[model samples]
Each structure stands twice: as structure tokens, then as C-alpha cells.
Target: MTDTHCTLDICTPDLVKARLAEAADTLRRLPSARLTAKLTAWPDVVQSAATAYGYEAAQTRPAAPSPEAISRMDETLGWLFWIENDGRRLLWARALGVPWRKLEDLDGRSHVTLKKQHDRLLGEIAQRLAGLPAAMH
Candidate 1:
């Protein structure tokens, strides 16, 4: 089974999925050729229109992750799922919303090690999310 716990302030996977669906719907409503023409004909004007109106375009909350970005994240998560070591795999799993565990079988590792790995995985995920061009974090 997979976990779906909320670990931070960002929306959950389910919410992100819903947002992606909404974004798709929004894109479908527009006439692609006309939208493309407007964008291509006046790239600078279209990009700056929001800013010209005193809108802090970049500072505002970002839209949901782009389809490509979500695909990349899903791929990364799959990689995490296959970690060879149970302890390390468990740590990565926690980042993907898996519940925390005691890992009684991994005797060589202590509580401190588990906590450190969890924190490290989280830091890595945060960095990855920060670098994504269209991801919400």
C-alpha cells in the first residue's frame, strides 16, 4: 500500500491532481490558434500585461505543477520506491507520505539515523521542488 499523509503546507497529491485537471479544463476552453497568435504576436506585451496592472506576477502563488514536472516527480518517486536497503527505502517512502516507522529489523540503525535520513530526504525533495519551473511548493 502507498501512503498519502500531508507533511507540509503545500497541497496534497490528490489536490494537485485536481488542480491539474482544472488547468486542463481551462486550457481546453481557449481556442489554441487564437491564443497562440496573441502570444506569439506580442510576447512581451502578454507577459507584461499582468505586471503593468501592478500585479506581482512572479510573487503570487504558483499554479499547479505542469504535466511534465508532475511526470518527473512521479518518476523520482518511483526511483525512491526501489531503493535497495529497507532503511533507506523507508526513509524515502516517508517523503512520499508513507507513515513513519520504527524499522525494528534494521538493528544497526538507531532512531537518530532514521530521523537524519528523513530530514535529508525532505531537504532533497524541497530542493527538487524549488528547481522545478512550474511546480507548486
Candidate 2:
């Protein structure tokens, strides 16, 4: 496939980055403790609002998140965290124009398996994007 051949309308490198970033922002805004744990496990830094507020405020747990909010956060985790590291590498490699053979060699996966992983990740991300509200897009 050519660099411009994006399968899903929202799967272009820019859209993928935007969607993933929006998802991350949604996760950070959620009030659920469970969702906060999801961010905690993420490699990136997550600044809790309470931390900036002061020590007294940090002691209090956030209120329960609305069901819609929880659903959004869960979807984000599904896309970003459920996939293993190798799957994420395929995404990054493709986005950055790395050769497929090199990725296969680096990750020790066969060509067929690598392609399958790439397609699967794209499909999953596409599905999740579809489920989100149109306003989010």
C-alpha cells in the first residue's frame, strides 16, 4: 500500500494522532477511580487535578463519572492499552515510514503476522472511532 492509502477515513497519521490524543484527554478528565488507574499504568505522565490544587484537595476522591464519560475512557484504554507493545510498534513504524521487513526483524515476527497485527490494530481503532460521538470527530 502507498503512504497515502489509509484504509479507514480516520486512520490517517494525523487523525490517528488526534484521536489518540483526544482519547487521552478524555481519560484525564474522567472522575472514575478505575479510569484513573488506567492512566496510572500508562507510561506517560498523568497529572491529577488535585495535585495542582494543593495537599488538602488531593485527599478527596473524585465523584463518580457519568456512564458516558466512563464509556469514553474505557474505549481509550481499549485502543491504547489492550494492545501489547509489539502491536503499538507496528503502528508507530507504519506512521513513521519504517520498512515492514525491518519491523518484522526487530520484533521477530513473520511478515504475515506483522501484517495481521497492523490490520487488526487499524480495524480496532477504526471501530472505536466509529463508536464515539460525531462531535468528537
Top candidate, metric lDDT: 2
Question: At residue 80, what lDDT does model 1 achieve?
Answer: 41
- Those runs of model 2 whose alpha carbons end farther than 4 Å from true positions after fitting are 1-82
The lDDT, on a scale of 0 to 1, for candidate 2 is 0.59
Report the lDDT of model 2 for residue 130: 59
Report the poorest 10 consecutive residues by lDDT, candidate 2.
1-10
Clashes of 1: 0
Candidate number with greatest TM-score: 2
Q: Each model's TM-score?
A: 0.33, 0.42
lDDT by residue (58-95, candidate 1, tens digit) is 65434445675455455444434333465346544344
Clashes of each: 0, 0
lDDT of 1: 0.46
- Writing each residue's lDDT as its tens digit, candidate 2 over 1-137 gives 12321233445434554444444555445566765688868574447755555644345544555676466545544566646786776775665556889887888878789888787786766666656665553
In candidate 1, which residue pairs get closer than 3 Å at backbone N, Cα or C atoms, i.e. clash? none
